[model samples]
Target: MSDALLSLENIRTDIAQYHILKGVSFSVPRGQVTMLLGRNGVGKTTSLRTIMGLWQAKEGTLTFDGADITGAPISARARAGIGFVPEDMGIFGDLSVEENMVLAATNGMPDPARLEWLFSAFPALRTFWKSQAGALSGGQKQMLSIARAMIEDRKLYLIDEPTKGLAPAIISTMVGALRTLKQQGATVLMVEQNFSVAKALGDQAVVMDDGVVVWTGAMAELAESSALQERLMGLSMEAH
Candidate 1:
């Protein structure tokens, strides 16, 4: 990779009494999908939060596109073109579908091109455009959340557990949308529990353990390394 869109070097973050990230470092190349993988309680989600500035790093540095942003505030970080979609989906049940999208954005107005592209890919969102978010299904809300992230053409995306509880068909839709993002020149760093999905979408994979990065390499390595699959991911590669 010539230039990393975003890089974390020796990043250590804490949440109250828990030291969540311990010197975890990795670089996300522009225009590639990087999946962060591990079993539950492995700090994958926490790492996403840290990148968003929801959790500050006590030690180490965060650099984006050659600038040092280790001390930037949450809003400042967002202004610098970092998009995040958390596991909860972060939809306002009481609001209309469009309103939920408008509310999730930290920037000014949501871009029309972004919204249009999103609706076109996830046509289900267009069907429920006038409906309230509370009435929409889980998969619809997830689509809305992702659309919210793309509103301003952010350079990087940090998505957490995107496939959790989604119907298999809907998961396929989500995967397609992510592929669209990649084609449009966005770097994606995703936290995923499902191996098949990650392997399908990710160009590179990083495995975390107890707040530290235990493995980092291409998805091909992830697919072939049985020892890593069993040890770090806690998965036996016998078969489905």
Candidate 2:
């Protein structure tokens, strides 16, 4: 993209006396997915939270569309076109699928055109529109979480893990959905532990270790080089 939608420069953060993010830096181009890859406890989740202002970073500059938002409240960031889907999926189990959708309806109406578009992309969500969120399957809940993030005219998407517990087929479906999101021009910053899922859809890979970004490059580069993956991601694959 010619212009960046969101950028994080040298971010440092701490939580409860334990230092987490250490000078993390990366940026998402307009309409592209930037995957954050690393082993568990590498502080990938913390990076997303700090970006959302859920955990204030001790240092770093966070800019959204050229405006400094390092100190902006989470709600303020949400209002400024930042949509977040955490590892937990952040679904309201007490609410029905439709109710969950309704909770996010505001300046952006539940416009028939948009809803139809989303429903077309995710038919499962349409099937369980009236079902309670807690009653849905894991894949269904993931769909709901992603759908809710896309409810508004969101400029950037901060998605933690969209394919954690899904079956292979469902993972493919989620990958397809992310491709559609990219096609529709949504800037995405995703954190994925599943190497296959990230390799399939991510444009670039941001490899983090011990709370700081250690490596970054095109997805193809990450996939083609096994040694790089093994060293940075602790991934090992056997010939099939």
Candidate 3:
């Protein structure tokens, strides 16, 4: 992929005595949403951690924007315009919503334009500005997590299951926000289990099984093929 902003080639990782992400490889295209999908325990989160340098890759290479980042530090990755929204949301429970967003800004101050856009995208953030993050609802917390990542202008965003445990309404709002991000020219690599949401937001799709890529193609093609979706997702149509 010549236009890939983030490329992972033969990536491998291990945890203690357990080996995960065996020879995983893929490329996330610039200014588009690429989805990583698979069953549970299929090295989804591990791959993200390795890319962020939270989990060291024992082998293979990672390149971001034509620069080798296999050995880059976590802070360095962030400084290089890579933003991450972990599964746990990674928010300060004790801090106010406004305070959390302020802390995520590169210079410790959120840009007024970006802040206004965020408030418009997630009105709850504006409403709960002074409220602690721990007091927010699940959907609001997810919004804050994403808001924090977007506080800074980044080249790529790595978000994990943003709709997990949220109501249908909130999920709809999240999907719209993700689409807007792509429209704003921010490349996105996301891991999601919801077939509907994945189809809605993904431009490219990669399916992983047993720590390696099993399938890769356009999201529209994957959405049209029930057989392929079942084979990769390990679930029946009714379940999905």
Candidate 4:
């Protein structure tokens, strides 16, 4: 994958005495969305943490934009244009929505135009701009989490399960915003359990099992094959 924006080859990560990612490998091509699909506890989140430099990879190489960043610190990786939206959302609960966005901006202030664009994409952010982040509903909090990450332009974004527990309406809103991001040529590697969402947004798909990559190819191929989905993901697209 010469055109990949991020590549993890034989990545192995351990949390304490537990070995998590065992030789996981995948490539996120530039200016496209790659869906990291798998069952729960299959090292999907662990892989994202390793790429973001939150977890140290005991072995393998992590390359971003042709540069080797296996040993780079988390801050260094961020500076190198890698943005992450962890499954936990990683927001400041005590702060106001506006304060949180300001903190995510590199210049200590949100650019007016970009802020307006974001507010347009996520009108709820504008509706609750001065409210405490912790007080927002679950869906609203998820919106704020994604908004913070998109506050700055980056080469690649690693997001985990953006629509895990949202209602249909909220999920639709998220899908719309992500579609706009894709149109803007942002490269994203995301872990999502919702097969519908994955099929809607993913250009490529990487399936993981037992801490290793089990399948990789076009999302359309996987979406069109129920047998493949059942074999790799343990459930057919119809079931999801």
Best by TM-score: 4
Worst 10 residues of 4 by lDDT: 1-10
Model 1 residue pairs with clashes: none
- Candidate scoring better on TM-score of 2 and 3: 3
Q: Using Cα atoms with residue i matched to residue i, what is each candidate's TM-score against the true structure?
A: 0.93, 0.94, 0.97, 0.98
lDDT: which is higher, 2 or 4?
Answer: 4
For candidate 3, what is the lDDT?
A: 0.92
Which scores better on TM-score, 1 or 4? 4
Against the reference, the lDDT scores of all candidates come to 0.85, 0.85, 0.92, 0.94
Using TM-score as the yardstick, the better of models 2 and 4 is 4
Comparing 1 with 3 on TM-score, the higher-scoring candidate is: 3
Winner by lDDT: 4
Q: List the lowest-lDDT window of 10 residues for candidate 2.
A: 231-240
Error of 2 at 158 (Å): 0.7
Q: Model 2, 192: alpha-carbon shift in Å? A: 1.0
What is the TM-score ranking, best to worst? 4, 3, 2, 1
Clashes of each: 0, 0, 0, 0
TM-score of 1: 0.93
Give the alpha carbon lDDT tens digit for every residue of 1-240 in model 1. Answer: 536898999999988998889999998988899999887887889889988998889999999878899989988888888988999997788888878777756654667777788888789878997899889889988888887787667888999999898999999999899888888878999988777888888898888889899888898787877887888767753342
Q: What's the alpha carbon RMSD for model 1?
A: 1.8
- So what's the TM-score on candidate 2? 0.94
